[model samples]
Target chain A: MIKDSTIKRSKVTLSNKYKNIYEKRFSSPLKRRLAVLKASSSIVSLGKYVILFGLSFIILYPIIQQLAVALRAPEDINNPLVLWIPEKFSFKNFEISMIILDYWNAFKNTFKMSFIVMFLQLFSTSLAGYMLARLRFKGSGIIFALVMFTIIVPQTTIELPLKLSLTNFLNTGVNLLGKSTTLYLFAGLGMGLKSGIFIYLFRQFFRGVPEELEEAAYVDGASPIQVFYKIMLPNAKGVMITVAILAFVWQWNDSYFTSVFVTDANVTLQTLTTKMMGISGNIQSAISQAGVWQLFDQDVTKNPLFTSMILNTSGVIAMLPLLLMYVLLQKKLFTEGIERSGIVG
Target chain B: MISKLKNNISKNTKIKYANDDELLKIERNIKSKLAKYHEKCEKLSAKYIILAKRKQETNKGNVKRIINVSRQIQRINTKIQRLVANLNIVHEKKFIKRSIVYKIKKKFSEIPYNKQKIVWGIIFITPWALGFLLFFLPPILKSFWWSFNDVVPSGTKILVNFVGLKNYIELFTQYVIDNNNIFNVQILLFVQNLAIDLPIILIFSLFIAVLLNTKFKGHQIVKAIFFIPVIYNISIISSTMSKGFGLYLENNTTANILLTTQLTTFLMEIGIGGSFIDIVIGSVERIFMIVNYSGIQILLFIAALQSIPNQLYEAAKVEGATKYETFWKITIPMVTPILLTAAIYTIIDSFARAPIYRFLEYAVTESRYGLASSIAMSYFGINLIIILVVLGSLKGLVFYYDKR
Candidate 1:
C-alpha cells in the first residue's frame, strides 16, 4: 500500500510538471515562439542524424561488404542464402591471397620505400615552402608559378620521357629505372607524388605564422637557416604532421609511379599496390599458379565468382596495413594535422 | 654636504658623455668600413658587367671569370650590409664590438641578417630548382618536341624523325581504338562529363562539410568514415567489385532495368522533362564515384569552415540574421578561397582518372611513342586551358581573410 502511494505521488508530480510547462509555454506570445523554436531545432537535429547516418553507411558500405565477403567460407561463394553473415567462417581465402600477393615481401618493400620517401619529402618540401613563404627575391614569383604548372601537368604527360632520361641518367650510362632509388631521388628533390600539394600546404601554413617570431630571432643574431631550425620548425608541428601523413599515405598507395619507375618484372621489387594491380588483371592464372585448384574441386575452381572472391580477399589484405595505421593515427591526423594545414589561407 | 653631492653627480655626467663619444667613434669606424666595401662592390660589379659583355661576344673562355667576379661582388655586398646592421646595433651600448670571436664571425657571417635570408632562401630551394631543371623541364620540353616527330626506341636510345603535324592531324581526324571507338568522340565525352561532374562534386562536398562542422551525435565517426575513401585504393576496390558482384548484377538485365528505367518512367509519368531526368539518373549512377572523388575536397572545406571565427555568427545572431543569411553572408564568403582550391582539385583529379588514360596506355603498349606523346600533349593543353579559365574567373572571387 505504501509503494503504490509513492508511485501515485510521483505520477502526479510528473503530470503537474508537464501542466506547468504547457501553461508557461502558452502564457505569452514570446514563450510560444520559443517553444516552437526548440521543437524545430530538435527536428533539425533529428534530420541531421538521419542524413549523416545514411551517408556514412554509403561511404563504409564497400569496406564492410568486402570484409564480410572475405570472411565467409569459400564454399559459400555460390550460396544465395549466405548474403552477409558467413555460415562457416574460414581463413582459407586469406591464405591463398597471401601467396598470390607475396604479402610479406611486398609489405616490407612498400614500408621501407614509403618511410624513406616520407622523410625526404618532408625535408625538401618544407625547405622549399619556407623559402617561398619567408624569403622574396626576383624570379621567385616565376618559380611559384612553375610549381603550380607542375601540379597542373599530369604525370603521364612526362612519364615516357622521364623514363627515357632515367634509363640513361644524364649520359652517365647508368640506368636508374626499375630501382627504388628512382623513387628516393624523386622525393629528395621535391618531385615525388603530389609533392606540389604538400609544398603548397607548407607555404600556406608558414605564411600564417607571425613574422615577428622570425624577426626576434634575427635580431638576436640568429641566421635564417638557424631561425628555420630553432624557431620556425618547432612551431610548425601541426603542418609538419599534416604533410608527413599525406606524403606517407600517398607514397604508400602510389602504383603509377612505382609501376613506371620500379618495374617488378626486372628488379623483383614489388609494392602491395603494384602487386595487387599485377594480380588483378590475371586472377585466374594467378589462382591456378597458387595451386589452389588442387584443394578445391573443379566445380568450385572453375566458377568466376570464386575468382572474384579471391580477388576481393587479396584487396582486403593489401589495404589492411593502411587501414590499421589510419585507425591508430587518425585522431592526430584529423584534429591537429588537417585542421591546421592552412590550405585555405 | 649638498655641494659635495652635486660635484659627484657632475662627475658621473662627464663619464656618461665620454662613453657617448666612444660610441660615436665606433659608429664612424663601422660607417667607413661600409663605405669602403661599397666602393669595392661597385668596382667588382662594373668588372662583372664588362666580363659579361665580353663573354656574350666571344661565346667562350670567360665563363669562369664571370662567375668569380660575380662571387666577389656578392661577398663584398654582404660585408657592407653586415656592417650596416652592426651600425644599427652599435647604439645599444652593451653590444660587444671588439671581441675576437665577434671579428671572426663578422668575416664569416658573409651577409647581414636580411641579406643572409635571401642567400639561405636560394640555398633552401636549390634541390627543388635543380630537380626541376634536370628532371622536369627537360622531359617536358623533350616530350613536346617529340610529339611532332616519329620517336622510336632503338636499343638504349630513342631515334626521332621530323613528322611535322602528322600525329596531331591523325589524332584529331581519324584515330580509332579497339576497332570502333573513335578517339575524338571519347575525348569530347570525357570533357562533357567533366563539365557535369565538377560542380556536383564541389557543391556536394561543401554541403557535406558544412553539415559535418555542426555539432551532432557520432560526428567523429562520420567524419572518419568520410575520409576512408581518401586512403582507399580506389582502383583496386572498384576493379575487384566490378569483376565480382557488379558483373553478376549486370548479367541480370531485368534487375538493371528495374532500378533505373523504372525510376525514369515514373519521373516521366509525373511530367518531369527528359534532359533533367538524364542528369538526375547520371548523378545517381555516378554517386559512388562522386563520393570517392570528394573526400579531399570535403576535408579542405571542413578545414576552411573551422577556421572561420565564431564572432561573425554571434554578431549575425544578435542582429536577428537567420541561419540561411549567415551561411550566405559569412560562411560562403569566408570559404571562397578553399572553394577555388576544391574546384581546381576536382578538375585535375577527374582528368587524371578520365578514360582517355586507356587510350594513352594502348599507344604506349603499341610502341607508338610519338602518338602517345601527342595524345598526352593535347590532353595537357586542354587541362591547362581549363585550369587557366577557372583561375581567371575565380581569381576575383577568392577572398583571402588576411588577419594582419
Candidate 2:
C-alpha cells in the first residue's frame, strides 16, 4: 500500500546531464517536446525510490522520539519538550525498562513464538499449496478453493471459536477483563499450534511453483519431502523470506493476541499498546491512582524507584530494542530476500 | 436393461404421481369404469353367441354376422384388461411426489458443504470473527447479557444470571441502570466520522498519491517521508500525538510553520490569516507542493499514461489535436478504476482509526463494550454500504482490458 507516488520518483534519477547535446540535435519544437517527454519519463522512474526514502524518516520519528526520551535522565520524563541532547546522559533508564519488562524472558518468549509460527505457517501452507497445485487428488480443487476463501475471512470472525477452543484445550481460566493465554494458543507457535493465515500465504506461494519440476525430481527417485526441501523450498527463497518477514513483523506486533491472552504485570511491548489508554494520565488521575498523591506529586523527579517506573518502564524501555534495531538495520529486517523468486504467487 | 425399461415404460403409462393415495384413487376410478364397460361387452358377447347358435339352426347368413360381432366384443375385453394393469402399475410404488421432496431436502443439505458457499463464509466471516469473538466477543457479550437483572450486588448469589437482548434494547430505549440514550453516542459518532474523516482521508490520499507520481528530483525521498507515518507504531504515534509534539511546529499557528514554504502546508493555510496576502501565499504554496509531489501523481499518470499507449498521443498529434483535447479524451476514462480503488481504501483506513472511535473507546472501559460493539458493527456496516454503492455505480462503466 505504499502510495504509487513513491514509485514515480524513479523517473528523476535518470540523468538529465545530456539535455544540451540532445537539444542541439532536436531543436525543432516537435522534437523538443518529444525530447522533454523522454526526459520527463526518465525522471518519473525515481518516484518509488524517493517515496521509500522519504517514508523512512516519517516512519522512524516515533522511535527516534523514544530514543531521545530513553537517553534523558529519569527527571526529564515529565518534560514535554526535550529540545536537544540532555546535559547529563544516563543509561540507568534502560536498566529499569529492561528489569520491569523482564527483558530476557520476554525476548525469549517473543523469539520462540515468532520462529514457531513461521515454521508452522511455512510447513502447513507449502505442503497444502503444493498438493493443491500439483497432486491429482479428488478434493484438490475444493481444498484450493477452501484456502483462498480462508484468506479473506477477517481475523475477528473466528475469534469466538478460537477463544473457546483454546480455553478448553489449555484449561486455563479466562481473564474476563484482560489478556489471557487463550489469545496466543494458535496465534503464535506456542510449543503447540500455529497461525492459520501464515499457512495460507505459504500455500499460495507454493501453488505458483510449476508442477513439472517436482514431477521430474520424482522420476529421478526423490521422496516428496526431499523434493520440497531440495527442489522446491530452496528455489522459493524470496517468497519464503517475504512470508517470513511478514510473519515476524506480524507476530512481533501481535497486539491483539497479547492484549487478549496475557493481562498481567508481564505485559509485552505489543500488549502494552492495548493497555495504554487504560492507564490514563492527568496529574490528578495519576496521583489518585498512585494511592500516594503528595509524595508522588511533590517528588516524582526525586524518588529513584517511582522515577524508574514512570520514566524507564513507560517511556523508554518498551521501545528500546525496536528503536535500536530499526535505526541500525531496518533495511535488512524488511528486505528479507534472495531476490523476487518466480515463486511468489 | 435399456430395452426392458423401454418395454416396461410402454406397458405402463400412468407414472407421474406424488403418492400412492392419489395414484390409487385414479386407478380405482379407472378400474371401476373399465369393469362396467367390460361387463356390458361380456353381456353383448353372450347375447351374440346365443344369437349365433339360433341363427346356425335357422339361417346361415345370421350366424356369420353374430360371430363377427362376438370377435369385436373379445377385442374390447382384452383392451380393458390392459388398461386395468397399467393403472395398477402406476399406483403400485412411490416415485414422483416422494422424489420431489427428497430432492429438495438433498439440495438444502448440500448447501452447508458446498465449496463456494464455504469460501464465501470464510472471507466474509473471518474479520468479524476475530473482532467480535476473539477480541471483543466474550467480554462484550457477557457484559451485554449481564447488564439486565441486577447481579444481586449481594455477592451471596455466586451465580451469573441470564438476562436477554434486553441489554441491547435498553441501550437504545433506556439505560442499563438508568434512562440514557445509547443512540446519542452512536449518532454523534456516525455524524462526525461521515462528515469529517472520510472526506479528509479520501481527498488527502488521492492528492498525495497523485503528487508522488511525478518526475521531480528526490521525489522518492519525499514520498518515503509521508508514508513513514503510516507504518510507524500506532502506540508511538498516538503517544506522540497526545504529548502535543508531532502535529505542531514550534508554534500552534500555521503561518509560523509554513514560513519554510512547504508548498502543501502553505497552500492548506491559504485563508489562515483571512486576507489577500494569505490567499496569494497559499496559492503559490499549493502550486509548489503540487509540483514537488507531482512525482507520485506523475507516476500514476505515467502508469495510466504508459497504459494508454504512445501510439494514441502520436496519432492525436498527427491529427492536430491539442494536449488538453488528448488528455480529456484519454487519461480520465482510463484511470477511473485506479482512482476508485484508492478512494475505497483511503476511506476504510481513515475512518477505521478515527479520533472519534479512539475517544469513544474510553467509554468502553466503563463497561460500555456493548455500545462500543454496536457502534463498531454499525460503522462497519455503513462503510460496507458506501464502498458497495460507489463501486457498484462504476461496475458497468469499468472497461476490463482482460475481458476485452
Candidate 3:
C-alpha cells in the first residue's frame, strides 16, 4: 500500500522523485518478501497435502486389497463387495497365508538379509562420505568423482554381470587362480539394493556440513578417526535413517537380482513372494467363509500342517519391513528430501 | 570386504599411478591437443554465431539447418576457453584458487607435477570403476564370451566351446531381426516397448506432475494415492489384476486396440459382420499394462517436478508474465533436463519391471533357459543401444554437484 501511494505521489512531484523517503521500499528483496509472506501467512496453503493423501490411497490400495483378500476366505477375494469390507470376516486365509508359507523363517531370512545389508551400507557409506568430505588427503577428490559418475549407469545393464558372479563365482569359487571355495561368500551384495548410490548421497550431504565442526574436534586433541565417529557420524543421523529405510524396502520388494543371487542357498527365502502363492496352492478356495469348508474338504497335499504351513506364512512376513519403515519414517518418506537423496541412487 | 576392495582396486595402477616425469608428458600432450581444438573452435564459432544471428533476423528454416553449425562453433569456443586457461595454469606455480575462471592465460607449461596429478585424476577417473569391476565387469565379460560360444547344457554343469561371437551376431541378425531389420518377438518386445512406452509416460507424467506439484484441492491426497502403488510390488498387483480386474477389462475397446489394430478387419477375419469383439480385448490388455507400471512414471515426474524451483515461476510473474507464458518460458526449459532423466529411467524400467520381463522370468524358471537367455540378451542389447544413443556424451543433464 505504501509503495503504491508513493509511486502515484512521485509522478505528481515528477522532477524530484527521490526527495521523499524512497530508499526503504526496494532495497533488500528478501526482507520485503519476508514481510509480505508474514502478512499473508494466514492464507493456509493446501496443494501438497491433497496430492500426498490421494497418492497414498493409490499406493495403499493394492496392499489394502491384498490384506482384505487375506483376511476373508479365499473365494471372497474376487467378490466385488470385498473391495469395501468383507461381508463376513474370517481369519482362515490369514492364518494359512501365515502358517503354510513358513512365514517365520521367511521373516527371519528377510530381516536377516535387510539388517546385514543395512549395517554394511550405513558403515561403508558413512566412512566413505566422511573420508571424502572432511579429510583432504591425496586421491580423495578422485574417489569422490568416481562415486558421482556411477549415478547414471543403468542398473539393469549391471544385472547380468552381478547375476553371473553369484551363480558361478560363489557356487564354484574358482577363477584363473584356481581358488576353489564355498559358503556362498557373496550371499552377494547386490543387483537391486544399491549401497554404492548411498555412499555418493551421504558424501554429498556430509560435504555440505560445516568443516569447522570436524576441525574443532581435531584442535581439541581428537584424532581423525574419532572426529569421524563422534562428530561427523552423529550429525549424519537423518541421511542414515533415510538410506536404511530405502535399502530395506528396495531389497524386500526386489524380484530380479535376489532371484539370481540366492537361488541355490536360500531357495526357501529368496523366492518368498512367489513361494507364498506356491505353498498355498489354489488359493481360490482360501477366499470366502464357505471356501474354508471347501479347503479342508479337498484332498490336497496334506502333510504335517506345521512345517508345510510355514511356507504360506512368508507373505505376511514380507510386509513387515515396509510397515515398519512407514511407521518410523512417515514424515521423511513423502517429502522433498527423498527427491534430493533419491536422485543419488 | 577390505581384502576384496584391495583386490578389486584397479590392477592397472601402472597406467594410473605412473612416474611423475611420464605423467607430466601425458598431461602436456592432452593440453596441447585441447589448445589446438580450442583455437579451431573460436574461429568456427564466431562465423557460425554471425550466421545464426542473420538467420534469426530473417526467420526461416535456415535456423534449424544452422543448429549443427552453430553448435560446432559453441563447442570450439568452449575448447578455446579451456586451452587459454591451461596456459594460465603454468604461470601460477603455487595456486591460491584452482578454478579455471580465476587463472590467467600464460602459465600452462610451468604448473608442477604433483598439482597436475590431482587435476588429471579429477577429470579422468571413473568412480564406478570399483563397482564396474566388482558388479559389472567380470560376469558380463564372461557372459559376452559365454553368450556367443555354445555351452551345451548338461544335467548340472554345461560343456562349453567358443562359437566366435555367434550368440551376439544371432541376437540381431538371425533369430530376432526380420530380413527387413525390424526386430522379431524377443527383440521387438524390447525395442517396441520404449518406442510406445516412453512417449506415453513422458507426456502423461509431465501433465500429472504439473498438477500434483501445484497448489490445488486435495493435492496431498492425490499424491499419496499415486505413490501408494510404488510400495506395493508390481508383480503381485499385476498377478492379482490379471486374475480378476484385468480379466473383466479384457472385453473393452482399449484392450482390443492393443490386440488388433483394426477392429473391422479383425471381425471380418473372424467371420463376424461387425466387431466389438476385438476392440474389447485390446483395450483391456492395455489397461492391465498401465496398472502394473503406472507407479514408475509418476515417481520420475515427481522427482522432476520437485527439482524445479518455485522462484522461477515467481520471477516470471514479477515480470508481468501470464501463467501460460511462465510455463512455456521458465518451466519447459527448467524441466527439459528431466526429460532426458525420464527417458533413461523409462527405458531401464520397461526392461526391468514390465510385463515382458515377467513373461521372460516365467520362461527362465520353467527351464526354457535357452529361450529365456535369448529374450534377456535381446532386451539387454536393445536397452544398451538406447543408452548409448541417448548418452552419446555423458553430459545429458548437468547434475547439481551442489556444494551446499
**Best candidate according to lDDT:** 1
Model 2 residue runs over 4 Å out of place are: A1-27, A34-57, A74-82, A85-88, A99-102, A124-184, A188-232, A264-316, A323-345, B1-231, B244-404
lDDT of each: 0.85, 0.49, 0.53
lDDT score, candidate 3, position B74: 72
**Per-residue accuracy of model 1 over A68-180 as CA lDDT, tens digit each:** 87898888877777777789999999999999888899999999999999999999999989988898688888888888888899999999899888888998999898889
Q: Candidate 2: what's its TM-score on chain B?
A: 0.42
What is the DockQ of the complex in model 3? 0.11
Interface RMSD, in order shown:
1.4, 10.0, 7.4
Model 1 CA deviation exceeding 4 Å by range: A1-22, A265-267, B1-110, B155-157, B246-266
Best TM-score among the predictions, by candidate number = 1
Clashes of 3: 73
- lDDT-sorted candidate list, best first: 1, 3, 2
For residue B391, model 1's alpha carbon misses the true position, in angstroms, by 1.9
Candidate 1 CAPRI level: medium
Q: Which digits, one per residue and each the tens of the lDDT, describe model 2 over residues A1-345?
A: 466677655454435536656667586898878887778766755555554454445445455655654566655545545444555587755664454344566666666655665655454455544554444345545654544333322333233334443444324654333333333333432111223344444454565566688778767866555666798778767566655655655555555545544444234433333333334244234334544334334555344334323432344444445445544543442233422422221
